[model samples]
Target: MGIHQMQSDLRAFARERDWEQFHSVKNLVMALSGEAGELSALLQWVEPGQIGAWIARPANREAASDEIADVLAYLLQVADGLDIDLEEAFTAKLAKNAAKYPVEKSRGVSTKYTELG
Candidate 1:
């Protein structure tokens, strides 16, 4: 399902439990941060260049996916609480990033756009 549909499903699930009262934007953001940290923890012990292979293991992959889902769910809840359309914001942000980091100059560089010159 699309992200919007997933958001609706999550919202319905929350409503069914009267969980909305606990899902304020601040709380959701804090939850999102915690989930992100969980995801990061899964990779904390892996060597930088070997993280891809580490995450490729089936068990690790599932664990990582669960953490990622938690992060997304909390992010979606925060968006709903704030009345923000994530898809629209994502597209707009991508466009802004594209303008700031044109391919010709950014193709092989990790430097910020402000430092490109």
Candidate 2:
């Protein structure tokens, strides 16, 4: 489903479970951070080149996928609770990043935008 639909479904789920009261922006942000840590843990010890194989393992893949969903769900809830349009925010951020790191200066570089010529 699209992000908007997923957000609606999540809201409905929360309402049905009487969880809306507990889903404040602060709590959601904390939950999102924990989920992000879970996702990062899946790749913690693997060499960069072996990350694909690590994720390809069924159990690891399942855990990673669930963590990813958790992260997205919390993020959507946060945006919805704050009345933010995630797509618009993403688009705007992309535009800003594009300006900060133009193609010629950023291509083949691993430097941050501020460090790029």
Q: Candidate 2, residues 1-117: lDDT per residue as tens digits?
A: 898999999999999999999999999999999999988887888899998888889998898899999999999999999999999999999999999999999998889997885
Q: What TM-score fits each model?
A: 0.92, 0.94
Best by lDDT: 2
The runs of at least 3 residues in candidate 2 whose Cα sits more than 4 Å from the true structure, single-residue gaps closed, are none
Ten consecutive residues with minimal summed lDDT in candidate 2? 108-117
Clashing pairs in 1: none
Backbone atom clashes (below 3 Å) for every candidate: 0, 0
- Over 1-117, each residue of candidate 1 has an lDDT whose tens digit, in order, gives 988898999999999999989987898899999999999899888998998898789999999999999999999888888889999999999999999999999998999999988
Query: Any runs in candidate 1 off by more than 4 Å, and if so which?
Result: none
Top model number, TM-score: 2
